[model samples]
Target: MESIDRRLVHALQIDGRAPFAKIAGVLGISEHTAARRYQRLKERGIRVRGALNRFRLGHHAWTLRLRCTPDAGPALAQALARRDDTFWVHLMSGGTEISCLQQVKNPDELLLDRLPRRLVDVSAHNVLRGFASPGTWRGLACLEPDEVAALRPEFEPEPPTELTPLDEALLGTLEVDGRAGYADLAATTRTSESTARRRVEHLRRTGVLELRLDADPSRFGFATQARLWMRVEPRSLAAVGVTLATHSEVYFAAATTGPANLVASVTCRSGGDLYRYLTERIGSLDGVRETETAPVLRTLKRVALSEGEAFPCHA
Candidate 1:
């Protein structure tokens, strides 16, 4: 069994709608205990919310990569941090290049399309066909120095095993359309409504699926977007990564191979807001060595798992 906190997080991850009483029964604890633990978890930044389906919400998505001047790394990072489409941002060794997750309504709005007119001496690589993580895979990475602090290590929870084919299809549909109804899913999967509902519950119970509404950021007033890349001292990565992940503007964070050792996706309401986040929040983090930024053009897809494919291909 998962630790109390992890168990609660896992329960919420599977189905944010699960009542405290149900979780209490599963963990053999009082409902009050479950509620108190949940409150504490949220205070510590352990979010247990539903995932969003960007496509269903009517927005375009894409990823963008950039090559920058080493001297401009910090400035570029600050610039990208201020946009809504920019989901993550980072600065690499000496700040020569940056990459980020970007989204736009149509091809014409791509930041890359306007880069030549806006910024000089920069190169880009745009991934037209790729997916993002369908679930929240990023958590604080453990560091050696962190062992000194009283940091409570959060164990990675176990993923559910053995989903039925019907379960898989229902999950696949919801991955793209979180609001899909039980009756509609039942019709598509050729099952009774009650059966479909049961399978959904099972999938949710076993941590195999999540069903929730995710809206496009633009619709909510966040308009600017970009991808930022950063290079930090290897020893300081854990602290730096955790700091970036906690930012309200940051949507995604992960370690990657490159001079810019870390990557992040950030969204903002305006260019001014993006700039303020980078200079005030990101630049203020300790152990950060340098950074880079790349504004995104258009997002083709945001990591929909319906394709059932794994990333970082292996032979």
Candidate 2:
């Protein structure tokens, strides 16, 4: 990708719904140029989708690691991807291990009474908290500080606002296309344009809706992507998670309950790059006692939701 494209992506990462004029001003391009570039990029696989803030809505998010039979992995992963609940699903360790992340209102649904009787084992980790996510990762941030500041959205801290059924219907459209026009959104929800616009703004200000840009790391020259499951000293887990999230290679990091307390998803340019990261970046961390690296062979789902998928701002 060119520097201008990276700048545009970075601006969107800061605020996905930023006006074309705002993006153009920051990138020193005309609004029409900015719009054209974005459309082209979208066609080339740069996607934006709206997601509900699960933690903010008092929902429990869990990451599951499944060790499956060699033949069952791909089909099982596809099945999981097609579901509205499972957002991130990856086939790792040469398609023998599956990593999935889903949000649930009741932790009991996943934690107990549900274990597929297949080959091997399964582990479920409840995300205690997230240090970094797609929205916060700045690894792709190429814009200058002032440029980023100019594009960042400003909103006061808001109390959690519950969503109505109509809001869920509206989000159904955004889950597929975050940049959908207000007219389209209103039509999908069968409401007036003014009502739809007002509701979306309210959701944004309240921290209920997050616009996530879905661009594969490989597109940006990071060919090697892996999940780092680190067993850290309990006392230093928080610090280690926070520090790892700041690294350029790490796109996702969180502290969770289970054997491996800290987990991160990292992308590097090559095998050599990954080795350097493990030996230099991760090795230097005093808290990370043992590290297990699971190379992500394929990602079947990411924030991908079908057009009719119902998010309801709950998960």
lDDT of each: 0.53, 0.81
Candidate 2: C-alpha RMSD to true structure equals 3.2
Tell me the RMSD of model 1 versus the true structure. 12.2
Clashes of 2: 0
Candidate 2: stretches off by over 4 Å: 111-115, 306-315
Say which candidate scores most in TM-score.
2
* Over 4 Å off, model 1: 1-159, 303-315
Query: lDDT tens digits, residues 1-53, model 2?
Result: 99889888888888888889989998999999999999989998887788766
Q: Compared with the true structure, what per-residue lDDT tens digits does model 1 show for residues 1-315? A: 135665555455444445677667766789999889866654553433322223222345444565665565566666665653554344543465555555455646768754533333453333222212313322222223332122222334444556568876776666554435678889988889999888766655443343422323453356776677778898987677667655657655555555666666677889899899889888888877787766554332333321111111111
C-alpha positional error of residue 275 in candidate 1 after TM-score superposition, expressed in Å: 1.4
